[model samples]
Target: MVDLELGTLPKGRGPQLSYRLDRAVLGGGRDLKVPGSNTILDVAGLGDGVLATTLTADGSGELLKLNSAGAVVRRTPRIYTLVSASDQAAAAYASDAPLVDGQMTYGATLYSERGGSVQSVELPDVRSIKVMAYANGQVYYSASVKGSEKVAKLYSWRPGSSSRLVKTVPAPLAISPDGKLASSLPATGSDAGCSTVRGVTTGDRLFQSCEQTIGGFTPDGSVAIGTPANTDGNCAISVAALNVRSGAVIRQWRGCFYRVVAEDNDNLLMVALVSGGGQAPFSKSVLVRCAISTGACERATEITAAKEVDFAR
Candidate 1:
């Protein structure tokens, strides 16, 4: 698996000014830098490459689609949150503060890109949007209203249809393919709480516990991969594959912390952090791929700090 890695050595004029964007193998391979002033903000999988939100030194933000070799093939306008299902389909939603409706609303734009055509709509009520999943032609997101910033609502929108409320949750994360189940956190900026899954319509919780934060669902939607807050006597972290409906752990790993960034049918791509011992902070970060069924791990990138490793989901 190739991971989105921040080049270990500093690039550009200053450390804060910019960083190099690169595609690197799971371990110790040459990092291929993307050509630009790419201070990477976030990225997501788009077909064989990745779509990244980057900031240039002059503060100009760019949305670029880079092929696997880290070369730009296409670029779009700046977007705050982006999600894509394939090269042919993608969505971006952004919000800015400008008073509306008795100062209760914010300025926002929601758009979809298909093939080479783009469709966009302005929203008056949404203060913010976090895209959870995109599929077919629809985009699913969690919205925070302007006044009720503490509250979270799940919504769905297709290019031609109006945005519709799906449900309400504390912090919506991922959704099931059939649009019936959703995973959420108990609260925002959680120090500790349950990573939960509930019915989108019925408001029934399918799984809830501090055991693990639900990372993502399998492509078939039959299994969920979760990462516990910590598994060590002090600092270790682990990943688990669970039966989606039952929350029963089927396969798991211990002794290291993992941030599961992306996955396909058979494996998960993650930034694994391993600590030296009890109560110690993670000493190293490495990109690795783990088999879904066997709990085996393979090296993807060299040992580095968390700031030096990144991946597009």
Candidate 2:
């Protein structure tokens, strides 16, 4: 069995609690005080250190680094709205603050983080950004129209230039690590029988899987989809992995998976709802690391009332 260490932090409180898991025994959760006045929006483990993004109650955000002791090492201002979901290093929303007026004008900012500072690069007019993926320093995103029909578009943004529409996807899109494959869901009006996975490089139709809706892509070009068995009320939820070239369902998991992150080749990290109720004050938010080959899932951690949370690599 793989060892696990689970950590928790209360809402509006800094990172103060940690739980250790060894074998089948779990140690008591402990609190480690840290200085900060922001809510922890996200946390990621990078190398031996930890990177955390926090948003203040005033809508300002910051990215911070911490050592193994839970002490702050560096902190930098991260002022962007609707940050990309795929890769944090590539693209972000145009405005540091949310827009008050309903006019649909916006841009995406691409940046490089060196040492502790971030240098900004600008992209073209793009709004309602959703997911972002990076490969070879290039950024890809799934965005949509701000109002009206609300159609989603897929674009690529490189440094020193504006974004180019790789494809105008009516549904959500996910890009592979090589930036060649784009697996997308079908449009609302299209037949809901199958999902399409397309190759952006050769304009070739790579693969198509039936009875599932494409959700996202893994870094290695593996496509993820939602199956018909998993549903939360009227909201459909399921997870599956598809081979990009063959368009075959290599592995699949049936459950209420709202958000998914491909942690590595053999593992996927997922945030799912508890069975108590579909609405808020949810039973609990669970984090699970599932083995791709065997579909065996081990409960890694849990959170309270977690809604609309995201995980990035």
Candidate 3:
């Protein structure tokens, strides 16, 4: 779950910027007030707890780990952008301009929640990194170079190990859990956002759709959630579940922009933007659980007057 601190302009005139943690399910949940947290960027299950990062309005960021009871167990100094997390550890990128041999370095570092040696990896000529999978001590990230648009690269590296280039997938790559199958948006001249699910190892195309954006891959790597490209223009954006093996659309949901926050073998946790009975700037958000077998959604929680929301799990 993502929490935001609502604050207005005019120098502390309205509500002050604060942060809270909440768990939303089909039935009920409670909000957890975190005293020092102002913004929550991402959260992931790390070992027996949750690992999260905060980016403040003052151009500062911090990585923190909270126990099962929502208490801060460990935290980094400052300026660390948390990237991805596995069961035993977490990875973060140094927000402070990192340089190796007087040249800028672009990569991520691994930190253990249990406290031990830190591992680091470096990639060249890429920025705006997005993590796809972090499991079994390996982290996979995708990014494009400054001027290149034809394809993007996915890199994989374990902690304290040298990085290896995985595959030059199409732009906006989404990989499966086992790192074998992937969905990528082709860089066509006009229909550039149209994506397809393909085999990363076999180079076989599984599925393709026009004007569709990849939401996420299922936990078991058998299905994927694909959303319409223009959610704002369309009255209702269709979120479709595509089977990776047979390249078929299994089920779908009609809603605004949806992000897959967490998933098990049978269900997906989605945060959706529902119309808040206002125009333009006025909007509302809600969290819901969507069943994988059937494309049914049960509203879990509604966020009241939130300006921004982000989730990681």
TM-score of each: 0.72, 0.65, 0.71
The regions of model 3 sitting more than 4 angstroms off are: 1-34, 77-117, 123-126, 144-152, 187-191, 233-236, 277-284, 302-310
Name the top lDDT candidate. Answer: 1
Task: Give one digit per residue, the lDDT tens place, for model 3 in 1-313.
Answer: 1111112111111111112233310111223333363666655554445556676666456766666566887777443444444233454343333455766445434333334345555555555566667655666666655566236676666767776666546564676765666777765566566777787767688777775666577767888777776666623355667777775777766655436533555565555666553234677765556666865556544454454544544
What is the TM-score (0 to 1) of candidate 2? Answer: 0.65
> Which pairs clash inside model 1?
25-300, 26-300, 26-301, 27-300, 27-301
Candidate 2, residues 79-194, lDDT tens digits: the string is 43323333333333232324557454665454544234445655445555543555666666666543433666776666556667775343545566567676666676545546
Query: Could you say which candidate leads in TM-score?
Result: 1
* Clash pairs (backbone) in predicted model 3: none
Per TM-score, what order, best first?
Answer: 1, 3, 2
The sequence of per-residue lDDT tens digits that candidate 1 reaches over residues 37-121 is: 4666666654445567767565545677676687888876546577666332454544334445546456567767655567877
How far residue 247's Cα lies from its native spot in candidate 1, in Å, is 0.7
lDDT for each candidate structure: 0.60, 0.53, 0.55
Q: Give the winner by lDDT: 1 or 2.
A: 1
Worst 10 residues of 2 by lDDT: 19-28
**Candidates in descending lDDT order:** 1, 3, 2
After best superposition, candidate 2 residue 145: deviation in angstroms?
A: 7.5
* Backbone clash count, each prediction separately: 5, 1, 0
Q: Model 1 segments beyond 4 Å from truth?
A: 1-33, 45-50, 56-61, 65-78, 86-88, 91-105, 168-170, 177-180, 186-192, 201-203, 230-236, 274-284, 300-307
Alpha-carbon error at 38 in model 1, in Å? 4.1
